[model samples]
Target: MSPQRPTNPAMQRLVDFYDPAVMGKDVGGRTLAQILAWRDTRLESQHDYIQVLFPLPEGSIFNEYSPVVDEETFLYLRHDSNDGFKRAMRRALARMLSFYGFDITWDQDAAGKWVVAVDAKKGAEEDHFPRWVRRMDHNHLRITRILRSLRVLGLEDEARAFFAALCWTFDSYRRIGDGSMKFWRRAVELPLHIAPDGTEVDWLEKYEEKKEEKAEE
Candidate 1:
C-alpha cells in the first residue's frame, strides 16, 4: 500500500502554523521534505520499538496528523471523563507554551472545536529529540522562574497542573528507545517548582536531594 498524504486541510494548517517564510526555508540544514523523510524512516524502523516502549491506548488516534498520547499516564489524563480536568489541561498547556515564548495559534474547525498549533521558531535546532524538548531546556532556569511567577500571580493550580502534565510527558518520552533518554531524564527535572516559603519543595527535587544526602553520609 502507498503511504498516505496529509489532506489539503492538514497541509494548510501546517502552513499557517509555520508561516510562509519559515516553512519555505529549510529546517536545520534539511528541507522540510528531507526532515519528513527522516521522520518516516525512523517511524518505520522504530514501529515495533515504539509499540513495545509506549503502547497505544485503546481507541487511540495513532495515524498521521492525529494527536497521540505516548505515555500511559498521560493517555489516562487525556481520556479522563472529567470535563474540568480536560479544560484545565488544555488551558495549562496553552499557558505553559506561552510562558516558554512559543506563539500558540488556535482555529475553530468545522465542529467549532479549537485546533491548536505552536508557531515554529526560526533557526531552532532539530535533533533526535523533539524540538520542543530542546527549546524547553534552553530556557530551563527561566521555566522555573515562570512557574514561580505563576504561583505568585494566584495561578498555582495552573502551574501545578502544567508541571504535572509535563513531568508525565517527559517520563514517557524518556522511557522510549532513544539514546537521549539520559539527557531527557536530567533536563525534564529542571522545571520542578520550588515552594516560596521554604516549607515545601518539588517532590522530585526533594526525593533526589535526600537520596544524594544519604549517599554522602
Candidate 2:
C-alpha cells in the first residue's frame, strides 16, 4: 500500500505559520522577507539537511512548509485543554519576533478561536530556508536569538532563567530519548561566560555542540 498522506489539521496550521505570506513583515527597518532571503543565502551548503515534519505525498508540492515544532508539540498546544498555554506561547513568540522588528498579529478563526497572524511592514523580496535544517537545529538558532535579544534588552536575569529552562527542557528530551545528556555542561553553563565588554563571548559557537553523554538517572 502507498504511504497515506498526512491530513492532520494541526500540520496544516503549522505550515500556515511558516508561510512567507504570513511571515512577511518589516523587522529592524529591513523587511522580514529580506532577512529571510539573507538567511537563505547563508544556507547555501547547509541546504540539503532541512527536514520537513509534514512531508506531502509524492508529487504534491503545493503549500509545503516546515515549522519550528514537531507535530506532537503543535497538536498539544492547539488542543482545547492546552489553550491557556497556547495563548501564552503565542504571546511569547510574538514578543520575541517583535523585538526583531516583525509586525505580528493574531486573528480569530472560524471557530472564534484566536490564531497567529503576521503582516509585513513593506514590500520585500522572497526568502526561504533549506530543507536540511531540522527543528533541533532550528530551535537552537531561535533560542540563541532570543537570548541575545533579551541580553540586548537588558533582561540578563530573565535571559538566564529562560536559558536555564530551555536547557533543562533539552536535557529532559535527550534523557527521554536514550538516557543521554548533551546540553547540560556547555549549554546550561553558557550564561556564566558572558563578558563584561560582550566582546569575548561566542554565543553561537558553543551552543552548536550536540554531543550526547549518558546521564546519571
Candidate 3:
C-alpha cells in the first residue's frame, strides 16, 4: 500500500517534500544533498558569530556525518499509538541515514526473534569521517535537521513526545556534567535557535509573543 499523507499541516508539509515512490530506497544524492545544504548553511552562518563561544576545528568537514542509533531506540515506535507518525519519521530518518552511508540491518536473538539494527555501510577508517557528529547536546546540526524535517512533516507533537520517551529511557549514555544537564533540560523545554554569540534562544517564547501580538491586532 502507498504511504498516506498526514492530516496535520506540519506533517503534510514534510509529506509533500517526500517522494512516496522513493521512500525506502537509499537516502543520498539529491535527497541528502538538500538536507546537508540546509544544515551546513545554518551552521556556517553561525560559525563566525559563535566561533568564540564554541570553537570547532579551523576547517572541518562533516559531509559524511551520519547519526546512527541503536536498535532499542526504535522499540517504542512499534506501539500502536505511534503508528502513523512513527512510520513517517522512521522512513525519513532511514533515508537520511542511508544517504550518509549507513545500512539497515537486524539483530537475531537466540530464540530467533529479530529486531532492527543500524550499521555503517562503509568500513573506512574513522579518520576518513573524523568529524563525527553525535547527539551529545542540542548544538548538533544533523539531529536538529531531523527534528525540523519531522516538524515540517506535521509530526511536531509526535516527534517531541517520541524524543521525551527516548530520553527518559536512554540507558546507554553515561552521566554528563551538571552544565550539560542544564543545557539539555533547557533545550528540551523550549524550541531552540542559536544566537549570534552562540547562545541558545527559546524561539517558542518568541512565537507565542508573535501570536499574542497578532491576537491583539
Global lDDT of each candidate: 0.36, 0.35, 0.37
> Mind sharing the TM-score for model 3?
0.32
Query: Please, what are the lDDT tens digits per residue for candidate 2 over residues 44-158?
Result: 3432112221121111122233333333443343345543433433344444433222345556789997554443324211221112122344334444444543333223444
Q: What ranking emerges by TM-score with the best candidate at the front?
A: 3, 2, 1
List TM-scores for all candidates, in order. 0.26, 0.26, 0.32
Candidate 2, position 163, lDDT: 50
The lowest-lDDT stretch of 10 consecutive residues in candidate 1 is 51-60
Please, what are the lDDT tens digits per residue for candidate 3 over residues 13-62?
A: 32233334343212232332244345533543433212111111121234
Look at candidate 3 and give me any clashing residue pairs.
Answer: 10-153, 10-154, 11-153, 11-154, 14-153, 27-99
Candidate 2 minimal-lDDT segment of 10 residues: 124-133
- Candidate 3 residues lying further than 4 Å off, grouped into runs, are 1-17, 21-90, 93-141, 148-153, 170-184, 191-217
Alpha-carbon lDDT of model 1: 0.36
Instruction: Please provide, for model 1 over 1-53, each residue's C-alpha lDDT reduced to its tens digit, 9 standing for 90 to 100.
Output: 22232344523332222232344322123333333334433533432222111
The alpha-carbon root-mean-square deviation between model 3 and the true structure, to one decimal in Å, is 13.4
